[model samples]
Target: MRIVKVMSVVLCSLGIAFAAMAKDMNVGFVYVSPIGDAGYSFAHDKGRLAVEEMDGVKTAYVESVKEGPDSERVILNMARKGYDIIFATSFGYMDPMLKVAKQFPNTVFMHCSGFKKAENMSNYFGRMYQARYLSGMVAGAMTKSKILGYVAAFPIPEVIRGINAFTLGAQAVNPEVSVRVVWTKTWYDPATEKEAAKSLLDAGADVIAQHQDSPGPQEAAQEKGVYSIGYNSDMSTFAPKSHLTAPVWNWAPYYKQIVNQVKEGTWKAESAWPGMDAGIVKLAPFGPMVPQDVQDTVTAKQTEIASGAFKVFSGPVKDQQGAVKIADGTVANDETLLGMTWFVEGVVGTTE
Candidate 1:
């Protein structure tokens, strides 16, 4: 009787150990750009680091993966290697991830800044325009020329939406301010981005803003003795003289929640677009050059936004052609915001 009891206890212990081993997850990440000091991929990599801090999770990543066939191959390799979850952190990886997800249905896939999803795949992004608008206010208040230069990436809805929000925020504070955009057609080219910034500076823009991934624009502004706004992460470190503020991303919280869902077996394929209220998107600290009154005003507005008392895309908004796109008292819905293709009034650029 004693021997049988001991045997039973040993079997139970073994079962518990096996269950713990089964809970271990192998996660992977695919980055379109090098996880340099700062930028979009660097921000996502920070999220991956947060996930690693959790129990029973192992992480791996392949950075600077080109967004075409190379990304598909890399994703398929990770899925085959038994990665339980994979995050494709680029807009162009949407189709590649979708195709790989179909083949590896058991492995969950998450794509950032894209619209495609599958039974085992999901998409996630933040309403970064909220932060963009606030940064625009800073530019409008600081610019002597009233001409803000925006160095842009591709002319997708994401870029267009940000530019419009910045322009709208500037016009709200300084009615004479106008934004001029120059596209780089690349997300992470420092040389091209800097040249674009210089071109804008030469064209009478006293302030510079950007949607590109590098701090080249900020550096350019610093060299030219002008103020600049940054994106993806705080760029003040790169351009102390010119950095005003940035609309930064904090991806750690969202990553931790998603990993927990996967571990608890509650993971589902859905689209998530969180905003300031969720702490997914935020503004970097103001530069020393920003005035106290300007900081107070921005803080007041930021509080209103976080508490849901104000909406950035509320109506009475118009396009550059003087035609009202959103009538007064009527707010634009998520669908309209996501599919935005026109510039707001006071913006001088073509979507094409």
Candidate 2:
């Protein structure tokens, strides 16, 4: 009887050890908006899904969490629940995520679109302006009135950089083109964004582009019989005939790479700002309305940007006031681009 009992105890201990060994790595994601929005959150969720498919990995998420105390609470909850890694996807979540990272030193935290980073936390964003420049080329080629409409989300550097890049691209193709901007100050308000698009249209803008989370601007352009550009994801379905091209985000590969690195005990904290060459950001396919010549031209430019043979912010760049922001025979670096707050020449909008 004693021998049997000893064997049972040993067997039970081994079983418990095996069960623990088989446990999957838990990953958590926090989003500012619902993944069903088919916009920004949706794009990140797609990356989460890719991570979910990995072997021995499990993922969960909280959606529609606000930026302030609410985001902090969600991140803390995930950390306390023993999530191996947490991803807070929003600019507003930056400070909150940094706070949580300091307490949960063992857990890894990744914040998107923010500048804060801790010993165990990292920030990452794509060079979306590169794709924006390409999309601008498309918009510039398609505009008939020489007036481009832009429905913007906020006056942040990210949005401002996109607007400026778009303006530069349009000006590259048609020096006579001008872009008008209207701010909605909200990320996902479809109705407000659509109205802003209409207002720009009313002001003689024949093409619309947006740095927003909804397809509202695209709908407005379609309703007004003009072309439109989209962001975050392929929005061609929403506007169909009026859709031109979009600067889209593809986070799957990057997310998968990070998860793999973490699992292998090789993950480190750093600012990751990859661009088209890394396959993080890309321009969506052109609509049927885009001419073949335009497509070829943009494709060549895309190749140039990806191959490091061209720099979008190369010299002679000017601000809205026509003051030289980038001198001739020079190029703007990542730091300048990150803190960009000025609109380029040919853009009719205030950064404020």
Candidate 3:
């Protein structure tokens, strides 16, 4: 098949368009980790499945390609191979994706967890902080030590905003609660992630939250007999007894939306950060460990958040050193939240 671009109309699997035949659109996925990792990358792969299951969409993915130079090669190869749309699923893939996108303007490209946007390019990510905030609600009620730990993956604003949301949610329920942070700086290094969790557990934390893809923190929490929360996917399998809840991403809906738009000639640049209402962000099953009352409270708060009546990062916020980050009655908007760099009050020093 020629590596040429499709126009407004999409081909059906049976050589026709939507006349009871499968739509034959080629879609591609570029992953930061393998789908079998059962964490961040796994979730994105699930989304690829969502696309494949669609009537006319066929999906292919390249896994474990590192960022930078390798990313450029990966995008070029996929486009050269005739993939209709390529989805770059890592923050670091931003520059490479942009470069390749310029070269292949006919190909539709989507980058997740990135901040860039262009005519033929769009950005998509969920308001995972909403789920993080809900999980912190459980951590607040369950912690007996009044200390919660967060294992962070990087210092980016996305990660930083999550830390703030988690801390703010915990303190909202328990005034005495303090969050201790440990930045591993590596996304999937099990050893570094586990060591970071161990350090926090040693510091008197009774519950843990994490942005890393591995279940190391949840596993460590189980060993320490403390409750835990997860990211990207439900990690309860790693620590059944220690599980609380998780901030799982539901990219399937978004994928379906974009692909259908592409197949219909209605595609356009769009940015989305949907929360609970939009169903893009969701809370994994709460373990039997969390009490009903606590679950009820979190459910109610989530409703408010979905309805725009509640904001986890509403202003009148402060940093760890007691500096005001958001003045009174001020809410932290998307710009501020995306650029956040400071830890809020109640977090201990960096675990590093």
Q: Rate the local accuracy (lDDT) of all candidates.
A: 0.90, 0.90, 0.83
Better of 1 and 3 by TM-score: 1
| lDDT for each residue of candidate 1 in 1-352, tens digit (9 for 90 to 100) | 9999777545533433343358688889999888893888888898999999998899999998988899999999999998888999889999999999888757789999999897678999999999999999899999999999999999999999999999988987999999999999998999999999999999999999999888999999999999999999988899998999999999999988888777766677799999999999989999999999999999898888889898999999999999999999998998999899999999988998
TM-score of each: 0.93, 0.93, 0.92
Model 1 residue runs over 4 Å out of place are: 1-21
Please give, for residues 113-223, the per-residue lDDT of candidate 3 as tens digits: 888876667887889888888888889999999999999988888888888788888888998998888888888877788889989999999898899888888899999
Report the lDDT tens digits of candidate 2 across residue range 1-352.
9999777545543433343245688889999888987789999999999999999999999999998999999999999998888999999999999999988766789999999897678999999999999999998888889999999989999999999999889988988999999999888888999999999999999999999888999999999988999988999999998999999999999999988777766677899999999999999889999999999999999999999999999999988887999999999988899999998889897988
RMSD (Cα, Å) of model 2: 8.0
Question: lDDT, candidate 3, residue 222?
Answer: 93
Q: Kindly report which residue pairs in candidate 2 clash with one another.
A: none
